[model samples]
Target: MWHAVKTLNAHNGYVCALIAKVARYSVSAALRKESVALVYKSHGDPMQVLKLQKLNLPALGDSEVLIKMLAAPINPADINMVQGTYAVLPELPAVGGNEGVGQVLEVGGHVTSFRPGDWVIPRDAGLGTWRKELVLKEHALLRVPSDIPLACAATLSVNPCTAIRMLSDFENLQPGNSVIQNAANSGVGQAVIQIAATKGIKTINVVRNRPNFQTLTEYLQSLGADYVITEESLRKPEMKDIFKNIPHPRLALNCVGGKSATEMLRHLQHGGTMVTYGGMAKQPVTAPVSSLIFKNVKLCGFWMTQWKRDHEHEMGELNEMISSLCSLIRQGKLKAPAYTEVPITDYKTALENAMKPFSSSKQILVM
Candidate 1:
């Protein structure tokens, strides 16, 4: 009898092994024949370092999901990262994008959290998004609503989240209160205007003077900017009259540093808060001592990556924020920046376009 029982157990183990092998082969068969990536062995000029590689999709591991890239933005941070100047650098031979939207193609047998056909974004930055496909652990992804605009979902995580956090986290702002920001035509700036507009908060926007300055101003105003002015226009004495019509700005979001940031600081009301998120100007932020001492203006900095790192414990709250942002998009309250899409094969053109001077729209890589 003991021999019979041992034989039965061995037979069951053999059957289980056969099932596992068959499942593995099924998954392998399910994946596409080819995959591609934009990879760099070392940081330097992105246009110089990034190259396309064609390869077969590796076997998916337990708790892993294979994703096909949908769209990824060419953000300023992406540019800086390739230059090896950003605060965080991936290990050598890394993928080049930090954020993007992707769809699950296949999942490992052990991955229960996601399935084929779900839309997701990297849970944090540095996921190497500029590619045709990637294999990532299911936990590294955050599911987003698949029904909304593809562009909105693709670009949702960074610029919009920064705008939302700066709007809510910094000051005790109420409806009817005013917010001011430079680089108002930027993705984050446009998000700030639309979000603040949704909340009935007024926005005083600043942008650089360009050949199409008036057209851009009109565009932003349509996005709910209470007022829009050029950086040079802001520094002019005429701003005194401009201030007469609107309440002094209570909060300032600074992306352009140098003289532009200094001017944004100067326009802040007494006890206002200035949050610096970027320095596209590539210059140091300057402020007069009197403004810091007498007016009691507060200067703070925000890095979206660091914010995510610090608040890793608040995932539920993060989900709530993400849901709210998605809802805003579904309702058309929040609009994604204008995007020019490039096929993965045309990445060279996309990078060059993003590097253009005063380029009118954002560039996104689409699979």
Candidate 2:
């Protein structure tokens, strides 16, 4: 089979041109079915082409499995990658989505852990998940609990993993220790707040002022946010006095870079660490050298890919942590991220909605 695939690639147009020579032979009808996929051809282009074309079900490798994508989300990272701004770039004409929940349809002969009908989620990023179906190496997928909602499971891979890493990587936060973060209304930010609450930690969330700021704050507070403040409020003269009452957070998570990062750093205690996970502001993180030298502050960055590669030994631990979070959902201790479901048939509209500014809800592509 591998030799046949290689031959097909090698012959290319020649084989098709010479099809008359083999027209008598019958081909399998299964090869004629079409599937819709989001294909990217160029970077920095506003147009995204979706193609519905015939594709044979990929033959399984010794360690591969075939899956039907159940749901996927349009994360900021997905958009960044599509726009060619992300650090990693896949070959052109590639499909765009990093996270998805799927159900296994077939498994290779040697596969031991999964079978048909089992639900799974991609364990890594850039697996071309924005399609009706996929064929991936067995190890690239993680089995999701059956009880987890398909929509929530679709977003589990990126935001939830990020939240877990942010809370675990910094100082071992105790029950009373507080942490500050910008973009507190974001998916990862919300996950962080809930996870921290589960661990008995406090969070000071900062978000841009919106018409529903009061309602938003109340919503976050319901998720166990110790305090929620607007970014504008952080610049007030009374901010310094407010700090005296709230413990100086020893760790900070900054998703919004630029001046917002600098402001977040100000709320950290001396000798504290601030990890920049994203640059949502499209600007560089600028912090005074005096803070690093005199205050002994530490600035770091986190890329989930690098972290996962370095900590392969902790896969079991990571799975356990996610399972615990799922348990919280079952007990109503953790609230799922607010989201709007977009049917896959109207993918263009979904993408447009995802690109809209200041949306309170995440956009999910429901299959």
Candidate 3:
């Protein structure tokens, strides 16, 4: 009986140890999340520097949320960031995306801003969006309406927001007013055309001469561009014919600086504003003396990142702009630019295609 009692005690102790070990493992597995991200340790050619690596996320904090990324587009700015040429460069050994949409898979106990299944987007640039999953503070994300298309939500924060602000803040444009913009086939340019159209405004889109110019023109026209002209067209005497139908543009949007901007500025209505948002040509904007002195063309620059930072605490206007854009998207008045969705595993292909010239399609990484 003594031997049997001793054996029973040993068995009980072993059972307790087994249960404790399983409990510890269960807690660990519950607390940790695994993710894969496109990480770059140094600035160089993106293809050479970017790597896919598994990431183990720390346990969620009280103000944190666990997100599963849905889609992220490879914008020119993103490419520039990876190349260390963009105005905003994240710290090295960082994930590679700046814009994307994700869905909440879980939220911390004290997190009030989001719950499971809520859709969210980075509140600003440089949140490292090229990943399968992540843990971010609630303040780092902004909730987006989930009913909209995934692709639209994935791309909402930067280009469209820039377009909306430039159109609304730069000029008090009324119906029948015309807006001229270069890089009209770009994502922001497309947004400008469509948003201007909804307000009964007209867009004179200028694109570089391409072999498929006619098709591109028709496509921009279909998106409500009233005029699609090549760089060469902006200089010819025939350009006067465009003004015969529509008044001279009072607001000029310049993404491509240098001669392209000078050409766009030449046609602006007297006292009109030319807001420079990008320097695609890598050249200084040269304003003709006559245009500056006589035309009173106001030349200014806009960086969306700065704008967001300025409005970080005062988000009422920002939220309104986002809501307004989403409403337009639901109504079909606005649409995402032409995009080719590539899986996250195929990021190399997406990155390669995005760097191609005259590639109209935006490369989107779908998780």
Best by TM-score: 3
Tens digits of per-residue lDDT, candidate 1, 1-367, equal 0000001122124321110001011233455456677878787888899998764555677887889889999998888777777655555566678789999999989988787899998877776788788777776788898999888998999999999999999898889888989999999999999999999898988988899988998999888998898888887887887678777788999998999889888889999999999888878789899999999999999988767767777888778888999999999999889889899789999999998888878899998
- Of candidates 3 and 2, the better by TM-score: 3
**lDDT of each structure?**
0.82, 0.75, 0.85
lDDT of residue 146 for candidate 1: 96
1-367: candidate 3 lDDT, tens digit per residue: 0000101122124321110000001124355857888988888898989998887776776888889999999999889878977655655666888889999999988899898999999887766788899877787788999999999999899999999999988889999999999999999999999999999998999999999999999999998999999989899987899899999999999999999999999899999999999888988789989888987889998878778877889778778888999999999988999999999899999999999999899999998
Q: In candidate 2, which residue pairs get closer than 3 Å at backbone N, Cα or C atoms, i.e. clash?
A: none
TM for candidate 3 is 0.91
- Candidates 1 and 2, the one with greater TM-score: 1
Q: How many clashes in each candidate?
A: 0, 0, 0
The candidates, ranked best first by lDDT, are 3, 1, 2
Off by over 4 Å in 2: 1-34, 45-54
Whole-model alpha-carbon lDDT for candidate 1: 0.82
Scanning candidate 2 in windows of ten residues, the lowest lDDT window is: 17-26
Clashes of 3: 0
Q: How would you order the candidates by TM-score, starting with the best?
A: 3, 1, 2
lDDT of 3 at 336: 94
TM-score of 1: 0.89
lDDT of 1 at 334: 91
